[model samples]
Target: MDENKSYLYDFIKGLWKENPVLVQLLGMCPTLAVTNAVENAIAMSVAVVFVLTASAIIISLIRKLIPAQVRIASYIVVIATFVTMADRYLAAFYPAQSKALGPFIPLIVVNCIILGRMEAFASKNGVFRSILDALGMSFGFAIALLLMSSFREILGNGTWLNMRVLGSWWDNWMVMILPPGAFLTLGTIVGVSRFIQTKLKKA
Candidate 1:
């Protein structure tokens, strides 16, 4: 019972306490670039989830076999293999999203979030625990991306998932969909989250 509870805590912590995007500030490339639309954000999130989870599992399974001197390189290789699979799969089935996301999907190879988790958690943990950690981190990243994309899409384009959400009378905020918009929106979210965290800590 205690073991199960610990695993649950491991999974839950990533949602807020150690969120990759919002808290850790990792993987910012896609967060700011592909988040102009909800669809793009979803696609990026799915790819990251797949890559991160698979890589964590594989790394945990082979952690002991890897030499300490070359562990980082080995982790990168493992992560890159899964990232290639995700890239090809996205391109094959979701060609539009694949094209929309461009080279960002392939760049997951160097995403600090994946490598950081592999080094900090997966490489040192058991398979089950690593899986939980990966799931938690990935979900945390997805949630942050979704929130950013949804907010930007609604205000910028008056749509959700490319579907109209606001009335025709609404004028879209052009700034909300641009590069600067991503920075501004994410800054605000991080500030608000930090403020709430401080309040909670004080209370």
Candidate 2:
């Protein structure tokens, strides 16, 4: 029972309490860059989920074999391997998303969220726990991306996933799909998240 609770706690915390994007503020690059549209956000989120979870599993399994001196480098190599697979698969089958994502997909190798988990949780824990942690963080990352994308896409383009959400009367806010819009959305999300967390604590 204690073990189950421990696993549950680890998994649940990342969903909201320690969300990588909203609360922890990690992986800001993709969070702000690719979130101009819902499709882009989904592709980035899926890629991150695969990369973070797979990388964590491998790192946890081989933690004992990796020397501390070159551990960081080893982690990057493993991360890059999975990232390459994801990139190629997307390019071959999901060319549109791949093209839209461009260098961002290949850049997952350096995502601090993935590397941070490998170094902090995976290296110190067993495979099962590491997987759970990776999943939790992945979901948290996805949620933030979805939230950001939903807002940007709907308000900016007056559509969600290229499907119209607002009527003709609604004027699309062009700024919402631009770089400055990403900053505004991120700041708003972070601020709202902080306020909610504070309220929850008080309650």
- For 32-119, candidate 1 gives per-residue lDDT tens digits of 9998999999999999999999999999999999999999999999999999999999999999999999999999999999999999
Q: Scored by CA lDDT, what does every candidate get?
A: 0.94, 0.94
| Candidate 2 lDDT over residue span 1-203, tens digit each | 57545989779878998899998899999898999999999999999999999999999999999999999999999999999999999999999999999899989998889998999899999999999999999999999999999999999999999999899999989999999999999999999999999999999
Pairs that clash in candidate 1? none
Work out the TM-score per prediction: 0.96, 0.97
Report the number of clashing residue pairs per model. 0, 0
> What ranges in model 2 sit over 4 Å off?
1-5
TM-score of candidate 1 on Cα atoms, chains taken together: 0.96
RMSD of 2: 1.6
* lDDT at position 107, candidate 2: 90
